[model samples]
Target: MNNKTSSFLWNFRQLKLNICPFGSTSIRRLMKVDPLKLHKSKITYQSNSLQKPQSSVRNFCQGVLAFQLEGNEIQKRSLSTLTSTSVGKLLNPRPLSFDSQCFLMSNTTPQLAEDGLKKITDSVEHDLSPKEKQLDFGKQRDLIQQCNSMSDVLDVFSKYPRFSCCNYFITMWKIAKNMSEDQKRVERQLLYEHPAFKQLCDHVMKEAKIVRLQQLMFTLYAVIRIGIPQNIYLVQVLLRVVQERINECDETSLSVLSRTLETMEESKNVDALRAALRLLVDKQIWTIEHILTLQTMMKCIGKDAPYPLKKKMELKALKELNKFSHVNSQYMFGALAALNHRSLILLNECSKMVVANIHGCPFWMLMNILQSCRKLQYQNLDLFTAIGDYVTTTFDMWKMKQVLAFLFAFETLRFRHIGLMNMFLKRVLDESQSLNQKEILCILHIYSSLNHFHECKNQEFLEVITSALNTYLPKISSLNLLKAVYCFCLLKHFPQDPFNQLLQENIINELLMSGNESSKAENMLHQVNACLEFEDTSVLQSIPITLKECSSDSFFSNVEVEDVLLNLFENKRLFLKNVQLPHNYFVDFELRMDSKRSQVFPVSEADVFVAKPDILRVALLCVPRSAFCFGTTHPRGGLGMKMRHLKALGFHVILVHTWEIKRLDMNPAVTFLKTQIFSQEAFPTATEFAA
Candidate 1:
């Protein structure tokens, strides 16, 4: 028979002997008397075995014999010890009386066996015992009956050394799961009810044996999964356990610990991990010391070992070492530099070291470090040389990928890395043929962020950017075309003439036609245009001349700009009701007379000269002024004092400032003279004017 069959048969025999102690002998005889009759006898034996226990083996034998004698086709058979062990044990040290056994055996019945089996099955199914059901219904009575204190639970769990094993863990889990609602409430209360439970849990966690430590780790995982408040303590206990296990050189323990650490990572429980690390450090755990020693050992292993094994060892060492300090600022740079120099041959080893160590530091901290480093080595040719050497050497794609991401991040924040940034950009652009859309987008985004378009204005760089765009533009998907357009537009006006004609002929028109409505891109576009002195005169003329294009449709479509301006004006009106004119408006404009106009006309019917007479008749408004001063060479034949001298010329002269007099406050003809002046000559220098 197969092992599975053998095991099943063995368990079945044990059960039979336990319930049918007195009937064995008679059943054996029935098996022998008529071998064909043994089948019915076995069925009868099974039926009786399912109920209450028989009183004695002799009584069971008598009952079976009586049944056989009644022509029940009894089959006598030898009693196998396989089916008799349980009954034999229970019947040991019995009274030496055959009659007592016979009475007990005769009384055994299938009904009693059935009832007994049902009780046992019910007990297992409901997790209820007769004693438990008899307990009180009130809260105080319930608490008094059960013992589910935190300390008690910990004590129970601490006794099991093989807690990490599946079987032991499942059992304990069932026990906890079986607790009533009241019991669970008591459990929680006991946990935080007093300082004693805390002390006990702490002690148990610290002093837990190896197997118990494994169990503790599982428990911590469970607690974390359940989102229990006790996770803080659990984390502390698990970290200590890991430290101990690592020191012991227990591979199994390390495996479990590694998985737990990864779990913590996946859950983003950095705070808990930090707390655990701090506890280990403050306690001076031997595991950390051992880890440091192992790192030294790996260094001693040098480069001669097999690459895979060496990588594994080195990675293990780095992971442990990472727990010693913040990864990004403390360890990541050195690790990256080492890999860059070829001192680290394995890319996986380098990646693990970098990822593990770097992630420990805050993102802002990493950003700060990168920024500071970028500025320090920005113009250094050696840095670029090193990067190029590293990127080209070994062809390690993983390291290259990480470096690219890192550089992208640095550039994204507009950190200074001039020499390396330029080199990297050149390299990437050169390899653009092989790059995917996502990779291209990342590069373009970083380029945009660093304002690298400004550098593209140089003749040499302009060709490169133009070439890249020409090659990639058609390949770029429609969704990303808008982004590429913005980047290209930025480059078009980057203050150089290498591509000036190309921009004016094609790129500018493309941008104007594309009509993207992104406010951010538009704003940036406008800034670029203003920086390069590109004026969108059509949009400007629509607004009041007194308002300057502080920011306007140069960055947006006419409709979008108008909507935004309307909203802005609405908000301004609501928030700044009393604020003054030009200060209140977002844009400001200054007006001046054309320098080339030798003669100017007043706003009158005669002065309204039509450039397009067939189009429409226009009227000009006029106002009277006080004084007009003419140049010494002026010829005489003027009809009247020309308003050009009164208003167009820059001078202070007196004029009557008028408004309608109302409310009977003053005489209607009382006119006040306001001194205003005009001059054709240029304003004096500061010194002359002051004098």
Candidate 2:
């Protein structure tokens, strides 16, 4: 009870310790007893009520060892087991018949290989769940339908996950080889209507998930092979989607955007191209280095290709360029300059077509081209000449006026050509014939800016201007008299000598008459003064008489006739009596006669003659009042007294009264006394005055 039980317990504890290090007691339990023999012994013991299992346990242990050895041999033959024996040890110990080892290795190899291959095949074949299989088939059919609806169904299929990658590409290649029109149409419609197509595009773009490049190539091929139309709306939507996708900072999105740009270029869908360019500019997606490519695209789009479409494309290109606010103006300007040069070339090329199809090319088109050139600061002299020639030759007078106005407004003043100025003047003069004073006024302003006022005097030019002025002046309301005055001033300076005569007789006198009570009179006076500088005294002499009749103090007030008087005195040593002088003399003097009455002597002989009281006032004010009558009136009859004093002083007086005054006051006593005071020959006859 003590030694034997203790020994058994000690052995069992040692065995438990051995198995404990192996991390499990199952091996220890197997070593302790055979479970099959124990089960059989237990069955016998249960039947006989006794335990007798020693022999059975031995046999069971032997059987278990044999089974384990066989399993080890099988594992080694299949090459699926790792052994602790070294390679040298295993080679020397594992001595078997060559045929037996080869046969065993061969038998195990096929079964392992088959099992591995079957597992892979089964995994591939059963990858989709029941629900996924249905979904995949449905998606495949949907993609096929989409491809059939559109001629370019590959664009949609390549965008679908179920059809994208290897699947869509292989299918697209097959469809491309055997494509029918109906099939192509159905594919295209399917693509056009597929919602997942856009989603797939967005996913590839946003996630940068380019699982395959072949799909893209096939999609592009299909688009081109099917011949994409110039559908602006479709292009716009595509461009917007591209823009949104490109904003995601992904390689796939950029690749897609770039590919779209290239496709747009090939299609010559300039509107789409411009739309892409505008997106680039608006998004500022490209770095400054990439702008060169953008600019090149812009140039290609703006080239003159055809009619409304070309114009539409060009305008869109210009608008896109205008969006680059921070772009280097010099770069943009250079690009625009190149574009302008091309435009001019195009204009020349199409000019003949425009002329032939006159109704097709409206004046606005030419005007817009010219305006664009100007706005871009494109100043080519040859282009300007061509434009000028076109305008002058093709446009009527009214339209010519608009063209000239644009030229005058926008063309550089420093570049004003003399020939252009001359042509403009001639056109203006001709066109202005039917124009009202206001319009004429504008023409005059342009002439003035060109400094062409003196040019009107050119005989040929004068005829046109005079005709225009004469025709339009009467119809113009008095409110526009100031403008007429400017025109008159231009006419006054024309180079023709006869213009001077006409001015003196007609224009100047009429202007002076019209200016009598109008505020415009002062301006007219200025013009009259300008003429006086030319020393055209015919008008000057008429001015004094006109002033005498008008009784306008202000009129006399403004006229600087002292200079004229001095000029006349210096030139002719002559002065007029009883004629108005401009107010404000720089010098004043009194003349005295030696007598008991102390009469003021005349400063000059011309100051002593008189014709009427108003004229007398105008002329006598140049000298002191004592020189003529101090406080005398017409009834006082100072003429006789003055003549007697003059006769006593040994002077001759001219009886210069008007015929009306002479006929009324002719008394023989008074006449004889006036004759004694002055010689009869001193008085001129009315016939001489008329002459």
Best by lDDT: 2
- Candidates in order have lDDT scores of 0.35, 0.38
**lDDT tens digits, residue span 1-691, model 1:** 7545554555456444633445545442111111112122222243444454344423323322211111223222322122223332331222112110111112235696455445434423344345644543343233322334444544443443212222222233345566777776666555445444344444344334334445555555554332234224434444443432332434333334433443353222333332233222222323444443333333222233345444555455555544543332233333333222132323333334434444234444444434434433322223323333443342334333455665675553334344545666666655656656566556656554444432553345545554555555545543355455445433332323222332333443444445564444334444333323332223221211121234332322223222232343333221111111111112111112234323222222232232322221111111111111111111111101121121222222222222211211232222211011123333223222111
Model 2: per-residue Cα lDDT over 382-494, one tens digit each = 54555555555655544555766655543332233445556666666566656655556665544433334334445566556556656654465443444444444443333
Q: Which stretches of candidate 2 lie over 4 Å from their true place?
A: 1-366, 369-380, 389-433, 436-439, 453-457, 470-484, 487-691
Q: What is the lDDT of residue 184 in candidate 1?
A: 60
Query: What lDDT score is found at residue 101 in candidate 1?
Result: 10
How badly does each model clash, as a count of residue pairs?
41, 15
Q: What is the TM-score of each candidate against the true structure?
A: 0.29, 0.25
TM-score quality measure for candidate 1: 0.29
Q: What would you estimate as the lDDT of candidate 2?
A: 0.38
